[model samples]
Target: MTKPTLADLTAFSAVATHRSFRRAADALGVSRSSLSHAMLALERDLGVRLLNRTTRSVSPTEAGEALLARLAPVLRDLDDALDAVADARGNPSGTLRINANESAARLLLKTVVPLFLKRFPSMALDLVAEGRLVDIVERGFDAGVRLGESVPRDMVAVRISDDLRFVVVAAPSYLSGRTPLITPDDLRNHDCIRQRLPSGKRYRWEFRKHGEEMAIDVPGVLTLDHNGLMVEAASDGLGLAYVPESTARDWLDDGRLVTVLEDWCPFIPGLCLYYPGHRHVPAGLRAFIDVLREVNH
Candidate 1:
């Protein structure tokens, strides 16, 4: 029995990931022939064909996929460990991948990231603005930001912002000739600006007051998917838009948009940073969480 070498595993991993010897060689900064020889040596030593190769392409065998499922993380951890040791001697340094909604990312960039970066100059932050839910760990993300209620129960979460409220508003010009909507029932007769979800269904306008809550299936002349676009269209006097109160505050203050049925607007859970409970969080993530606690506390 012979001991496996790091080079053997790395070449196999690279080829498995790239699915082409030429691409794998480019990624590993080696010649194609050298990479092919290394894999052949590895297969000879292991006495198994780990990869199925053809003239035009390369693919992993069944055993290769299982090996990849196990080794990919292990190799990644090995690389991370090396970086950690180097980082410990100098500064807290690593890329922090965070998935968040566009609004939260905007808020963090405006309010949180400046302070965090001033303190840890070496850290890199990749904040992805995505509306859909993501499996942070499986997707190689350090953490995710979502509404408190939207966070998965299996993950640990820390509050980053206070409660949020949603408001229904329309541009002053658009409302000039239209009758004011005093109640949710009035919205049915108005040209509401509706938002479409990622799944292509129109978002239902919801309202609540005291102890009663209801969803209004209001008709609209225009529909959009992005909140930023919805706000812009409403500001241009297209139609009424139901949006987060915080997002509409500036427009409302400027008198460009008028809030309607304020009493019916509901306060909901705000943004939270959530991560897997079972895994050891990286130093970069720990530092971010610490800053969140300090700021929100």
Candidate 2:
């Protein structure tokens, strides 16, 4: 048994966290070959295979997962301690990674991002936007932004925006000949731009009014994954798009798109910035949260 250097252990954690040498190397600002060799040396020192590497992909072995589970908290504590010292000196400086769905990302970009960067000139933000809901802890993100209801129960959430509403919008040309749209069921008669969830399921158009609720798996000639794209399609008169009101706000205000079923689309919960409750919130993350509240209020 031999003691591995702190740097080697840190690199091992990064590789295990990402499950890809190239990704870990890029994040660590090292070459892939060097990272691979380092991982190999780490495994040899421990007398256990930590990662199962293939030509196409890499994954942590059972032992690697166990080590990572214990190592993550230790490394996080060290980071927090360092961040505290840095905070004592002045503005926090580090990269803050956030994973968010497209809608939430757009909201953050519009509201929190610019000010946070301007306020802390040394801080860097990596905002990854996609349709998928990822495990922020496992994926190595400082936080995640999603609608309040979608946040995992174990995490602490802070509201970043006002309550959001989803509305059905269409170009006037597309609405002209369509029958008066009233209820959720009426969508069947009109072409809609269907939204595809990251899980490969078509989103069921949900509506609530007068204590009645309905989820319609609306029919559509076109299916799109992103809300912004759906809004664009609807503006092109392709079909009705169900999207966040903010995403469609510009078009709605300029008369490029008109809303229908507004009564059925009542305000729901707003976007939230969430993170694991157990881990220490780094200085950069704390400062970032401050910016969110400042911009939000």
Candidate 3:
């Protein structure tokens, strides 16, 4: 057996992180063939297969998973140390990856993203918009943006937006001959457009009234995963949609969609930027946080 060089380890780490040779190569600014060769050499030296590669996808094997679990934190620490030095030299530069839902991404793009990029020209931001709550650390993200209540308690959360509210709305055409929705139970009689969560469960519509909270499992014929699509469906006269107030505002104001059960809608804590509490905050993340605070104010 031979000792693995730092390049070998780093390449292996990148491949394991992304589970794709091409993506890892792109991220590392190298050729896929070179990365594949490096992985082969690394595996030969270790005497164990680290990856299961097929024509369409790549994934870590048992040994690779073990190695990845150990390598991720150590590599992050090293990167942080380097970023710290860069910060001291007044040249903070690194990639800052963020996991956020569509609404959060929209909010950041509208308010904070431009300022943050202008302030930290050397830093690269990768914003992944997803519907599921993800493990930011495990996924190699610097942070995640989620609703305050949805953020993990173990992570440090910073408020990024003001309080948010949800609304149930439908186009006039759909509501024309339909029974009026006067209560939460009225949703049962109407054709609702439901949202599908990443976990494969349907998102139940939540409402609040006079200090009491209720979750309604509304039935619907169409199930969409994105909020934008839900709003579109509602506006197209397909069904009623329960979505964030911000998402439906334009449609509601223009009479493309009209709100229902507004009194039952509840104001909840807004989006937040959350990250691991134990690790050192990189300069890029710190800069982003500052911008978020500025925009929030």
Steric collisions counted per model? 0, 0, 0
- Best prediction by TM-score: 2
- Whole-model lDDT per candidate: 0.84, 0.90, 0.88
lDDT of 2 by residue, 1-297 (tens): 678999998999988888878778756768999999988888888999999999988999999899999998898789978998978987899899999987778888888898999989989998888678888876778899999989999999999878989999999999886689978899998899999999999999999999999999999879998888999999999999999999999999999999999999999989899999988888899999998888877
- Candidate 3, after superposition: displacement of residue 192 in Å? 1.3
Ranking 1 against 2 by TM-score, winner = 2
Q: Which residue ranges in model 3 land beyond 4 Å of their true spot?
A: 1-3, 13-36, 45-77
User: lDDT order of candidates, best first?
Assistant: 2, 3, 1
The TM-score that candidate 3 achieves is 0.82
lDDT per residue as tens, model 1, 58-172: 9999988888789889987987796677458745686788899888899889877887888888898888888877666645577999999889999999988999988988898
Worst 10 residues of 2 by lDDT: 20-29
**lDDT comparing candidate 3 with the true structure:** 0.88
Candidate 2 regions off by >4 Å? 1-3, 17-34, 45-48, 54-73
